[model samples]
Target: MIAPMALARPSPQELWEMDRQHLLHPWTNFGPFEREGALVITRGEGCHLWDAEGRRYFDAVGGMWCTNVGLGRREMAAAMAEQAERLAFSNTFVDVTNDPSARLAARLADLAPGDLNRVHFTTGGSTAVDTAVRMVWYWQSCMGRPEKTDIVARDHSYHGATYLSQSVGKRPGDRVAEFRYKETGIHHLSAPNPYRRPEGMSEAQFCDALVAEFEALIVQVGADRIGGFIAEPIQASGGVIVPPQGYLRRMWEICQRHDILFIADEVVTAFGRLGHWFASEAEFGVVPDMITCAKGLTSGYVPLGAVIFSDRIWQAMAANGERWFTSGFTYSGHPVSCAVGLKNLEIIEREGLLENAARVGDYFLERLQALEALPLVGQVRGRRLMVCVENVADKATKAPLPDGVNESKRISDAAEAMGMMVRPLGHLNVMSPALTITEADVDFVAETLERAIRQVTDELVREGHRIG
Candidate 1:
């Protein structure tokens, strides 16, 4: 077993120096960071966090948009430890499966919308999405349409990081933009960005135009050649771009009409993040063929993910002469992770955290919009705990700043100095806290955000940055 971390105290300066000298962080440039230090988070509970220096602050970002159930969960720790001590290693391959794996699969089947009764486990969101992509092509092959294997994903929609998942993700973080995965028949499409809609358009008209564009893409790609279409029901990482009303439903219908399998990448939006077990059923009134989920599944206590599929796809894949599904991970269904997932679900349901997200999320959304009066804030958009504040050059035109402005980074840095951590996607400041956050906590987030934006905007105005 890997050695446990020692309970030793270290100074912030020491830790930062160690990070600079030894650590290679992901998605980071180490050269510039060598001169400066890193922010070290020490502890968290409820909707708050403490830095290495013991400064308390509200966790507005919820640790990379996970931690839906909050932190310092003693019960979760106990559950994971108990499982680890028990049957810790068991392969879910061939005829071997653990009790927790079976039980958690059944629990998820019951909770999933429609007939997504078959659960395939993985270690995290990336692998789960990677598995889903492979499964779609495999299903197409099984159905005897090898050529119908194209995938269509929306702009700025984040699926995951594995090859196929990365290819499908049109998110700004997508480094694969210049590469052509189209050799494998994967395609990208545009989404209805309501905040930045074209001139002389109402929200309803914008949605209609979006629908028409989507239909045009399907036709242009040839409906017979497209195998699957995947999306995040709320587009969390894609600037929390919540669609206008009926947007999701319309997209799902278009997929159905084109005979394309619909997949929902619910890695961030599932398990009470959207005040529902799954956001698809709540917002779109339709269930997808497959739903890839991670993050809050075990509330970040343990690493786990799942690709839930309907019986139609499951049966078709199973009844074939091929015995193996041809895709999975060694720790796909780890016993400890399964046990933690079961416990996490129990806590979420027993404590009504989903309902809390609904109630508190409504309050947070209303208050977040109040920041629009500030010059830097263009539009505040999101649903439930997932929200984004778009930074614009001019509120009247809704135009984003020039690429050199980097308003997102400036505002985020200011928030951190104010003892809060926030991240930006494009020109939008993304915020998603614990589902258990209270109304007072929500207010604190709003007030702190106002302070951060005001500070940044004031500095920019004095510096002659076009924030107006």
Candidate 2:
């Protein structure tokens, strides 16, 4: 039997005060937060969240684009609790191992495509990326090519906030303000963005240009000196950029020709966010030397991440028997996290959530695109449920709103006021609903989004703000 609901909790004012006084929020300006209370969310279920006041809103952000199965799955919770009670704190420290860890490793090997058979566990995406970086260096060292230590990533790419991951990501304004920025052959490539193509060039021509640029960079940098090239399959935090047709394939060919390792950062795109187990395999049809994934692995049940190593990488490491990669987090293969991940994967397979994302995703995309008729929407781009609406000042000129003006934030705030949760990624309003979302739920998203946009646009117009 389901447990009875507890009585309503204390007011949000109390919680906010507690948070400001005691909690150190990530990536926050503490001074502003001290003056203004934090957003105190209390509960979540399915595609909805309830604040301390019990106010419900559609969770369009999916808890930072991770919770693909949605909120409050008792099954996953039970699995975690059960594992915690049974054998919670075991370590996978080379010699010692746990059942859940071994099982999860095997399960990931089965799920991953190509010869990605070896699983190296980490705490989350950042650590996974860091692990990949270390592995690349180690592989080079093993192959007696220790000089091949440089990495290449695309502009607007987001790997993570760790030392090496941040070094690898080329996102503007994401640079470490305090640390010295390294320029160790980490080349940047122009993304296959068709909207901002070269003058008088079609998308096909633009794709060719981007490919040529990357290939030339590989030669200029001397491919022998570079370890690998890494990128998100569809740039998620990079404004949900869906590359031009044939773009990913060309990049793959370039990497192959240069003998540079290819890495797919699938942290945000894996596990049905884009209607696929692995977005790289499903969308681009390209395999990589290593794949990093987290976020949706356990659908936010517990902290988990992985670096899936291919057979070649594994063999190289194994060949150097005494000199294994000495890289692992203390909680890398936490038993509870592994058990929860196992259960979560079973849920995805049993419920066919991957297929569900594909089936219902078209409706979501179509309805989101329908919003382009609005003057405030400049573009709608995504695959499956991983969607984005880029706000522009003028559709004809494709100009953005004033810099320092958070138009996407304003729209998101408006949506929240209208009882829907939306997230602003720069000037782009984005959503990645639970993979289990229904057609009716998608319809509601469309209707509610239209309502929010209309309200915000009308207000902006009243304020005499220029908007597309």
Candidate 3:
């Protein structure tokens, strides 16, 4: 139950002024900032959100691909409230312990695939990834392999915004930019994009080529110098790039053969996003040495993330008896965050949302596939609830819309005007609604997108833009 707050919230105009005056948003280009004020979201409930002006929107993007169980779960609010009242703050720096933290750690250990039973919590996805990559250095140092100090990731992988994580992400613009950048030993391999691969290559051959590229890179980097290899099962924040089948398995084999520690950054795939609690093992058929997950961990109710390491690595770290290589956050194992996670996992299991995602996902993708009939649609691909609709000028050439045209943003605006909110990654429209979304909701979203794409196409065609 939501506790009744007696405080009067700021008006939309008031809030926007305050934000514009002081708040700088992440990933926003502020040179041409909106003078009328930003869209202020005042409240949310079950797969939907409302602006301060009372405009309701179906949140197809799931609050930046988090919000697994939708929104406004009074139980989750109550759980956090109870925990906050019980113990609001506690540092997990040293020997400190808390019930929610301890219990959530065990819960993660139980759910994590294979022997990835060790849990180290963090504030969010970026920190989790930052910590995991740093752990690779520590692991190598502890094991006396200090020469292995490099991190290899895909060119399209989205790790985090931290120095090490951002260094590895190959992107033109930041999800959130930073002044302090590093061009250290972190290297980026070619992104695995089947849609954009050379025309006429079979999926099998494409997979082999990708594996070969990774292997060649490892050789060039020198096996002894590379400490870890990381990848997202489904590359989120980078256009939801789903690689060819058997590609990840092959990559895993390559990493193992090269003695490189494999880390699966499942920040976007874990917790029912791909119809699995963990996709590193379930979807890809490879158990990573470390798995970093967040976002859906607490369903956006509380900030939390974790890196689950294998038992062997934990044992090795433990073996560093007298000496220690330490890295931790002030809110590393924040009790309130863990409590929310516990409740969120329960909701996922109790409602069988994972199974729901697996079942409804087929229908969802099918409905989305209907949009392929649209002239502007370049490709429609996704697994389970995570979907993308790429708008292209030429389907045959896979040519993106004219530079600076912002076709994706146009589609997003059209969708919003039609009562749905989808995220735009360049020309790709990303839709990852709540895992508990139904076939009806999928239809609504697809139909809205269809209308939006049609309108956007007409606009582009009239403007003399190239068309398929």
Highest lDDT model number: 3
Clashing pairs in 1: none
Q: Candidate 3 on 1-468: residue-level lDDT in tens? A: 864445767777778887788887876567645564467898999999999889999999999899999999999999999999999989987688899999999999999988988999988989889999888888887788988989888877788887777877776466344476667778888788888888899878888888888888877989889999999998988878988998888888988887789999999999998899998889889999999999999999988989989998888788937756488888889989999999999999999999998988878888998899888898899888888988888888998876599999888989999999999888899989999898889889988999998998899889998788
Clashing pairs in 3: none
lDDT of each: 0.85, 0.86, 0.88
Positional deviation of residue 170's Cα in model 2 after best superposition, in angstroms: 2.2
- 189-246: candidate 1 lDDT, tens digit per residue: 7776787678889999999988888788777878889999888888888788877888
**How well does model 3 score by local distance difference test?**
0.88
TM-score-based ranking: 3, 2, 1
Question: CA shift at 403, candidate 3, in angstroms?
Answer: 2.6
Candidates 2 and 3 compared: the better one by TM-score is 3
- In model 2, the Cα lDDT at residue 412 comes to 86
Clashing pairs in 2: 375-468
Top candidate (TM-score) = 3
